[model samples]
Target: MTHATHTPRPTAETWALIRDDYRSGITAPVLAERYGVPERTLRRRAALEGWRRADAPTPSLATPPAWLRPPVSREEALARDPDLAEVDAAEGGDRIGLLFDPDPRHLRLFAFRQASEAAAMDRPVQAVSWMRLAQIVDRCGDRIEADGRPLREVDHLRAAYLRRLGELLPEDMPADDA
Candidate 1:
């Protein structure tokens, strides 16, 4: 008769080394070499323990930092569930406005109900510091309105376009070019 022997589980010392090194931005390859374990084993253990990749930051807790100072402070976070904090945590920092460039032939005004709506649907977009018609134009190429009107730039964009237009347009206006 033959007896089958079971390999001993990793010691607490091994687990501690894994955690400490992981938080300090050590790579799995390095950890594997130091611990004499396979790289895949280290990664699998990290995954099971909810350790995130080195490049990503840990999600915030149920209650945000007091420093957040939400523009519209409700009693609770918008999601209202601590478990969902992971999702919100990924969206750390302030809100942003995303601009979408529809097909060249399409012409739609800014009619989104909420910023989240645009994010929910993956669209060609750019985040703008301020949500203004002119700001959108500055970020994207010039666009004409559906009514065949050339939408003029506003404020900063106006100056930029005027300079660009000057470079493109001739100084002398032809009699028929009026």
Candidate 2:
């Protein structure tokens, strides 16, 4: 005769703590390690029980919470955080031009600036998105100019940029349609 080994189930109190922690934005892996439970088991339980993380947006809500709403105007935003007022004033005409301008150089510069800001904020994914936007702008060949007018030789410039992009990209990256 052979005896089967079984893992003990978590006590009600322990399970409650796990649920609370998971709902409050603690990752399943961290909670599992803290409570001596398997990460897979914790994840499965959380999924089955519909454990919504505190940081996640609730899809079922008819109207989002006030904190999720954007400020109505720049004045309202500045009122909320007075520190932004000086930056806003300094960027006034240039910021408006950045939004309205279709110039590829300006767009590329804007994308690079966004990437830098996102990187500084420790948001790698957002930074990568901005960098990709910059690359897209560069590859479009709208930056090539002759006598202050965009050059008609766009196809050649685009082909060259695409070749450069392929060289810079990792071997495993998906091929772009460009």
Best by TM-score: 2
lDDT tens readout by residue for model 1, 22-98: 86888889988787777898888887787866776877677764434343333365547667566555433222222
Superposed Cα RMSD, model 2: 17.1
Worst 10 residues of 1 by lDDT: 104-113
Report lDDT per candidate.
Answer: 0.55, 0.79
In model 2, the clashing pairs are none
Q: Mind giving the per-residue lDDT tens digits that candidate 2 earns over 1-178?
A: 9996777889999999999999999988899889989999998888778898899876666675444454257788699999998878866755677654447787788789889977765677889999999999798745342234433468668978999987899998777789
Off by over 4 Å in 2: 1-73, 81-83, 99-102, 118-129, 141-178
What TM-scores do the predictions have? Answer: 0.28, 0.36
TM-score for predicted model 2 compared with the true structure: 0.36
> In model 1, what lDDT does residue 51 have?
81
Q: How much is the lDDT of residue 83 in candidate 2?
A: 99
| Model 2 lDDT, full chain set | 0.79
